[model samples]
Target: MPWDLRDGEPVIDPAQVRALLREQHPDLAHMPLGEPVRGWDNTMVRLGERLALRLPRHAQAETLLDREAAWLPRLASQLAGLPSGTPHHAIPAIPTPVRTGVPRTGYPFRWAVVPWVEGTPAVHVPLEVRDAYAPNLAATLRGLHQPAPEDAPASAFRGIGLADIEDRFARRWDALAGGLGRERRDQLAEVWRRAVNAAPYAGPRVWLHGDPHPNNTVLAGVGPGPMASSPVLVDFGDLCAGDPASDLGSALLHFSPYGREAFMAAYDAGQVPDPALWARAQGWAVNYALIFAAQSPGEALRPLGRGLLA
Candidate 1:
């Protein structure tokens, strides 16, 4: 059931919103409310109305989502083909009014009311299904890295790179005992440094859905063209423009060698990436997995974390 937006007590609890859905959009509200999708970084609620509400679980998310809104359009030319959670002008950062009886001034964290793309998040699909899946995902990634014009519009965000990321992990590790043993951590750190050195690509810059997790991927009924039947990418809050490999967290960390081959074959069928950069992508995938771990305590992201570490 859809949320019946009407005048009433300020909706304070998320449960209250669910209640409104039941009272209003019975067809949707009653179907089944999946457990609230939780991420240490954010909270998500799936609306029965073919949409999802993304509530930034923290203040940092406000900046990230805002950046996404600003940057995605620059890559619209290529993203139109891949649309995996690409930021849309139609979606608004609608704050769920914090209903405090008399009506409080604002809602909880910065939030966005997003369109929910149908299909499952790619968390635990079998290896067999992956053969078909990886290519689609690769095609989407290809579209993301498509060459852009020299004079084309670009993203305004000028923020941290792999170094800022390294610092984050270093500091986070320092907060713990032993700090990820010298030898192994050093290897990871060296890789991180290499990725940093290899930053700022000279290749044509294009927008990427900075965080394209299995959860963020959703299969839309086949659309059109070579890439049409694949899962449509969704979740654009982390979108950015840069070396496309920055988004290959899955290929390097999650996909098997065979899976990687299939994905790469599809992604690089006609175009090839700088070999040096592709190596850097391996490091990015590892770091991305680690960085992503700090965002949530879910069994879903665990195997990917283990794979990256391995």
Candidate 2:
């Protein structure tokens, strides 16, 4: 139950992180450890200017960190050689792990030192200005959807067919129905049912970022107007191989109708998706919204949850 809702997970401050570094990685221990960037799963401490130390705040995040350590290097190597006209080639950049650390002293889980990627999280970007970055986001997803190696991690509930998680979705949908408008609730129900019945992805398994929400995507320079900007995709904790539709949830959850259209347009420009894929993406959106509502309802992600249901 790593994903289970809990407020009592152990905390790792700069002092504790410094201690771990001093004991296990003294070369990095001398570098300044900046304030920690707190997230639901991990607390990332900026280690000097170029690297970040990511430590799990919750038990479940350990497995995800290990997944990233095992898979990202292989994925990064393939990204450069992907087809030229494909979205993978269009991605701005991705984080590279400098070193992976094992449990030591006060820290009881695996951790990593990754290159600190630049850009603003889509959540921090204003709604009025988000349309400009949609296409870049689409390209990042398209790039990440390349076929994974045979031994890539399997995320049972993440990148799998929507039908596989339908029951879990139904329960969360029931819980969320209480606070939503009847119209919105009805719309969500219809969207979920249609997606559940739609033809599942019949293509070969491709890499999925697992969680492609706004916070995970970092935009470098999001200038104004309709001008597009390439965004760097980060936080590969949920990396797995499965339906590409599962990874497209961020476009709907983070953008306006216009932005959603722009994203699909950019994605189709490279490789057109089956129309049915939209239905499955919508279902994955529901899954994301409901999970946030159930686990951390007051979180910033809840705003996107409402948008997804809307």
Candidate 3:
């Protein structure tokens, strides 16, 4: 039976996915299918050993998947062209789609088959463990933050000036009043204010992973220590072109107070230091934390939201 159905969304099941595969991609139809892993926008099921099927669970996600299909390949090719041993080359992987699935009778949305990246979600890793990879994360973002073409997608909710989202932030802030104490709320409010007042990014619009929260990052490794794990960014559904700070702010989610310092240091060494950019990044952190805290309090990200606020 279909589960977690939203308004105007269709019921998706293993059988339906298999049917889609059989219809569109006959060769892979025989491959084993794993249980569905549902995200906010998409439902993913592992297809055999090498690839996974990414299908939209909601109407809005259909466009997101389309965006990923259209853009990730270009980004991957750009990364591939970088010289080896460069900071950009250090990025382990970007899950570009190998095959695409068009919408058919039952499945109304386009989907994709991408290489199954192996790693533990950064959220599942200990903060101390994640701390080791702070510089790695910095390198990953540095590699990705290139000038985007004019036609590159833009988002109203992200990659824009903090002042633009002031009203949206105010609404989320009000909603958080009941759950957060005065002190914490005030702290967040102050951060948001600074972010809004800070000088906006004057640089060219750069490609952003869009939603680079802890959950979206995968820490791939075998043993312990700093050398063991590498951060692999995933879920480009929110991918867009915007201010690099929009992506840089995610360091707060992946790090503690000390780890954040390391991230900034490494990032600063690579790019020209900008105080306002960091301030705006902090504001973006506040914005993401508020979303986790206010919109999904019952979910796992609530603790993460509070921790970021702290």
Model 3 residue runs over 4 Å out of place are 1-3, 83-92, 177-183, 221-228
Please list the residue runs of candidate 1 whose C-alpha ends up more than 4 Å from where it truly belongs after superposition: 1-37, 68-106, 146-200, 219-229, 292-298
Query: TM-scores of all models?
Result: 0.63, 0.89, 0.91
Q: Please tell me which model should have the higher lDDT, number 1 or number 3.
A: 3
Backbone clashes for every candidate come to 11, 1, 0
Error in Å for residue 286 of model 1:
2.1
Ranking by TM-score: 3, 2, 1
Ranked by lDDT, the better of candidates 1 and 2 is 2
Worst 10 residues of 1 by lDDT: 94-103
TM-score of 1: 0.63
Q: Model 3, 81-187: lDDT tens per residue?
A: 77777643354378888889988867888888988877677887778877888888887788788778899999987788888888887887777656777798787
Cα lDDT over the full model 1: 0.54
- Once model 1 is optimally superposed onto the true structure by TM-score, how far is the C-alpha of residue 93 displaced, in angstroms? 20
Candidate achieving higher lDDT, 2 or 3: 3
Off by over 4 Å in 2: 1-9, 85-92, 221-228, 295-297
lDDT of 2 at 24: 80
Q: RMSD for all candidates, in order, please.
A: 8.6, 2.9, 2.6
